[model samples]
Target: MEWSVTDLAERDLYKLLVNTVLPRPIALVTTVNAQGHANAAPFSFFNVFSHAPPLVVLGIEGRDLGDAPLKDTMRNIRATGSFVVNLVDRALVDAMQVCAIDFPGDVDEIAAAGLETAPGRKVAAPRLAASPVQLECRETVSLSLGTRHRNLVVGEIQYIHIRDGAVDERLHVDIDKLDLVGRLHGADWYVTMRDRFQAPRQTLDTWRAQQGALRAKPEGEAP
Candidate 1:
């Protein structure tokens, strides 16, 4: 079966993408309003795009639920040029959900979620005290797309904060200890990193060794 994107509705296209994307990391972003009120929201459309500049990219939808209502986080970043990306661990999953609610502009999502906050070293946006890992990022660039004009926020990570027990002397993170969770298909669906597997990458020489006799030799040169 085949489907043309143009023939499909936007909602259907979005559903198709989400359902097939597997699990995505959650970013519980925190920003500050002009009045210094702390705002927190969870966005699954987020990931680290680069390490050279230490960039984190977040795909922010239009402001409102039905129409572009102008999200507080977007406005705050546009106004202040900085925000914090907090990792969602098992302990903070419920609080992250509370922050995802579509609250009024005046409502402080962080406060409403009953999460504690601490000032960031490199940005005005605060950090979620419950989060095991947090990134203080400064807006470096933004791109707009989609008919509703969604914003792609690309920010440079200025500083990273990790819980004392999460990392080791060599700066290796004990991922399991971090207890991070990821977003699934539906509103309440999620996955833990506890279950994982590993596969070693292969090089050409290794590949040739594995297929010794199977490899083709010069025509009639040798058996």
Candidate 2:
């Protein structure tokens, strides 16, 4: 089946995009308004961007068909200039889903999810105690995308909290220990990090040597 980008409806394109993206990291973001009322919501359209300043991106969509109508997170982030990105692990998956409920802007989803919060050192937004990792970020910029105005919130990581056992002395995070979960297609679909494979990148010298051998092969052969 072929899909023409111009012909496909926005919803259709959105379905294709989310389904084909394989597995995307979930950002259980928390933000607080000036009044200190907290909001927690999940965004699968998120990922790390760079390390130099340590940046992450969250593609937060507005309340469309009333799947979480409260834009409290976005509003708080924009109002306060900071937010927290809490990483979701298998143990806290259900609690994380609880925060996704469409509560009122004044509702406190963190408490609704029955999770504890740790006050962020640098940001007004607090971090989730159940989260294995939390990033306290200050918003750098926000870019509007598409007709629906889905926003791309770019933030520089100001502080990071990693559970004691999740990282080693060498700063190598233990995947099994992290036990992270990723968002898959559909409402409740997800993938775990328990199954993994490693393929080391080859050195330039090794790559050049292999290329030389391939070039030296008889041209008429499989060229």
Candidate 3:
């Protein structure tokens, strides 16, 4: 029931952490190399860290094959200083998985995955056409963590592209219409946002009013 991370293997710790996390958003990141080659990969260790300046963080790991020093996506970001974060939806799940493969550095993942790319307005990196949401970002900071295993990439949102009807002029996005998918534990596992319900947090006044109503009710009365 209890396991010490230091004692456990890295793979064991990774499995425990990922499974316990339940579900995480998938960032299908796209970046352009110095030679203009496009690279795409899906990262589950990603999330929005700030909103005022529109910032997001990506937790990237070293190459599993030990063949390279940096991940192609990370290398491209460092070379170009720009990247695109595309939301992985149910429609593009298969293609996204293909991009996750450990392909050669020169391989064009966008073409290899057979996914359509759209020219970004603000950034040089092309956005995934199938993705419902695409955020063009400029690298703000690339912090080296632990020397080897981890790298935290922080990016500032330059421009956002949402699918038609998904967002309004006020920038309010309709979640139901987006049908976004998230990464689950294990290989090829995914979760959908279609089955969703809202449970608003109760205020102090609202809680007091509910308590008062309960106290006023007869002992035998149903709530």
Give TM per candidate. Answer: 0.91, 0.90, 0.91
Flag clash pairs in model 1. Answer: 63-70, 64-69
Q: How does residue 9 of candidate 1 score in lDDT?
A: 89
lDDT of 3 by residue, 1-223 (tens): 9987789987898889998897899999999989888889998899999998899999999876575678888988989999999998888888998899888666677898999999878888999998999999999999989857578999999998888998888989898877889888887678998777899899999999999999999999998
- The residue ranges of model 1 lying beyond 4 angstroms of the native Cα positions read 64-68, 213-223
Q: Which stretches of candidate 3 lie over 4 Å from their true place?
A: 64-67, 214-223
Q: Per-residue CA lDDT of candidate 1, range 49-114, in tens?
A: 989989999998885466645577788899899999999999998888789888877677788899
| Lowest lDDT block of 10, candidate 1 | 63-72
Sort all candidates by TM-score, best to worst.
Answer: 1, 3, 2
User: In candidate 3, where is summed lDDT lowest over 10 consecutive residues?
Assistant: 62-71
Evaluate model 1: give its lDDT.
0.88
Q: How do all the candidates rank in terms of lDDT, highest first?
A: 3, 1, 2
For each candidate in the order shown, give its overall lDDT on alpha carbons: 0.88, 0.88, 0.89
Candidate 2 ranges with C-alpha deviation above 4 Å: 65-70, 211-223
Candidate 2, residues 1-223, lDDT tens digits: the string is 9978999987898899999897999999999898888888888889999999899999988767556443777878889999999999998899888898887666677888899999999999999988989999999999877656478899999999999898989999887877889989977799997777898799999999989989999968884
RMSD of each: 4.0, 2.9, 2.0
